[model samples]
Target chain A: DAGITQSPRYKITETGRQVTLMCHQTWSHSYMFWYRQDLGHGLRLIYYSAAADITDKGEVPDGYVVSRSKTENFPLTLESATRSQTSVYFCASGLDRGRSYEQYFGPGTRLTVT
Target chain B: EDKVVQSPLSLVVHEGDTVTLNCSYEVTNFRSLLWYKQEKKAPTFLFMLTSSGIEKKSGRLSSILDKKELFSILNITATQTGDSAIYLCAIGANNLFFGTGTRLTVIP
Candidate 1:
């Protein structure tokens, strides 16, 4: 009920299908981020939101969409899933200004595109 | 382009051995460097280094940053099997840029 949590801990979807991974944080941190972890690529940031209604693209943003309608929620959507899109998705929250700029991560969602 | 690169992508060692993980980065508007330990699930934060030459220590783990060389190193002394995990390094600038990470395996 506290910290950050992700939904659909594991998912398997067909290519071209749409899938949405949910992330919710109780800390209500100003910054929320979506990242995908892939072998040989590590955790690549897909999108990040500075605050509610303010989002920006990160390193690997193509084929992925993210929205932060509320400070406590940041969801990532795969409009047309591809095999390449199959990976572990992680959501993190952090405060913008503080000595602790480190992010707190969610449990993560393992998605497989078949 | 902002990038974070970790060295010795994977390592294996016996318990009681010492290991040093390296992370190098090239980014604009440098901010802070962070370390994370990832097991089967999500990554857990370890340390965040912003100032150069100051070592951040926690138990047997320690890390230091060098902004001049654009690099950082994580040292673990007397490694144990429980320490086996993927250690990730991320650079914080406009956004956090993470390295591929070093998978450390401590054999008993």
Candidate 2:
């Protein structure tokens, strides 16, 4: 109950539709991140937040948007979902700026776009 | 760009066997290395190693990092079917950079 959690563990939407995945962390960590996992690509960061209302893009930021209005919540939105956007999404919170800090991940949300 | 690479893309082993997962990295200002076990969902933290905390162990899982070599290894002893998962190795720079991950499957 004190850890990170994701909503709608599984989701499906049609191409061009808008979809949003939610993440919540109770630790109130200063740093939050969003990543996508595909078959061979491993986990690629899509966006990261340093603090409330401050967010930055990661390696794969295209086709996605993230906002952090509060320390406990970081939501990822797919403005126009595409078939390639179907993948597992993970949310993480780190106590520090990532260096020498371990991250705690949420359960993950699997999205299928067709 | 920062990068992490893992070896033995996939492995199949029988229960009770021992396995080693390898991870190497190239990053600016390396700070730490981490290992995680991923089953059906997100990855759970198994070990975190830094210059100050170079070795960490829990149960049958153990890991160590070598700053000189810029690499790390994770060893699983007397593995069970429950150990079947994707073993991920990540290197922490200013941000965390993950390796390709090793897919381990243990059969009983």
Candidate 3:
């Protein structure tokens, strides 16, 4: 396919355990983002990468780490998972060209921490 | 802090009815506003608005952004069962700020 994809569509981890969600995009977009979708919180950006090796924190980045070693891959890691981290995580990609800033999302990974 | 707020957290309407979803934002260095339609999986892109007054349309769905008012509205006409989904509004600046989203249900 020629779109974004996430691995382990569904995941479950115990509290204090480490978990990582993988995201890959085939479009080679320069901007990749990680977001968590919760009940009351629609989608809060956890981290984003402008390009390979260039990452920045977003609205909600605590307890989470992200790396973009390659342009097609951006993975999110939870150092110590907590029950509060249980939510649907989405990965998106976009271009940082002119005035267009629209993003395309992946299927999303449902993570549960108990 | 930058923020995006959506109105009418949830809505229910008949199949043939029309609905409008609102999104207001308070973001610094606002670049653009985007809308997405989510069913059970990832949210699909709907529209991206940067300028004001100009309306963007696709099939039965349309949206307009008001840069001066710092808000946007998505409208769906002749809604169908497939129109039932969560409509998300996001603001683009340094990154993207998303609203809680509006859950719309179109009943037969």
Candidate 4:
């Protein structure tokens, strides 16, 4: 209740379909991020938001889209899911400036595109 | 491109053995390095190292950063079964760039 959480912990969908992953945090942090964890690539930033209504592309933002409509919610969307998009997705939140600016991750969503 | 690389990939050791996990990075605006222990789900923070040479320790776990060499090492002494988890290293320069992580197994 006091930390970050993700919805649809596990999902399966077909290619070309649209999928959305939801992330919520109770801390109301200023920064929210989305990352995909793969076997060889590790965790890569897909998108991040500095605050509500403000988002930017990360390392790998080609097929993924993200939006932060509120300080506590940041959602990631896959407009046209591909098989290569299958991976574990993580959401994290943190303050922009602090002694502990470390991001705290959510439970993660495992998405499989068939 | 910003990148983080971890060494060994995977490791197996006895409960009493000590282990060192390595992480190296190549990125601009060098800021801080962080370590996390991921078990089944989200990664939990362990340590954050922003300064070089100064080792940070907690209980039996310690880590040091080397800005000159662009690497960091995490050390765990007297390992336990509970210590068997994927150790993740991330470099934070406004945002985080994570390594693939080292899968560690501490056999009883």
Best by lDDT: 1
lDDT of 2 by residue, B1-108 (tens): 788889999999999999999998889988778898899888888888887435788998888888888888899999999999999998777677888799999999
Clashes of 3: 0
State the lDDT of candidate 4 residue by residue for A1-114, as single tens digits. Answer: 599999999999999999999999999789888999998888889998888999999889999888777899999999999999999999999886643349899999999999
Cα deviation at A44, candidate 3, in Å, is 0.3
**Alpha carbon lDDT of residue A12, candidate 3?**
95
Across A1-109, the per-residue lDDT of candidate 3 in tens digits comes to 8999999999999999999999999998999999999988889999999999999999899999999999999999999999999999999998875533688899999
What's the distance in Å from true for residue A24, model 3? 1.0
Model 3: clashing residue pairs? none
Worst 10 residues of 3 chain A by lDDT: A94-103
Interface RMSD of 2: 0.9
Local distance difference test, per candidate? Answer: 0.93, 0.90, 0.92, 0.92
Candidate 3's C-alpha runs over 4 A off are: A97-100
Off by over 4 Å in 1: A98-100
lDDT by residue for model 3 (B17-85), tens: 999999999999898899999999999999988899999999999999999888999999999999999
- Backbone clashes for every candidate come to 0, 0, 0, 0
Candidate 1 lDDT for residue A102: 91
Candidate 2 vs 3: which has more DockQ: 3
Q: DockQ of each candidate's interface versus the true one?
A: 0.85, 0.75, 0.88, 0.82
lDDT of 1 by residue, A40-74 (tens): 99998899988999999988999998888889999
The residue-by-residue lDDT of candidate 1 on B1-108, one tens digit each, is: 788899999999999999999999999988899999999899999999999999999999999999999999999999999999999999888788899999999999
Superior by TM-score: candidate 1 or candidate 2: 1
When candidate 4 is compared with the true two-chain complex, its DockQ is 0.82
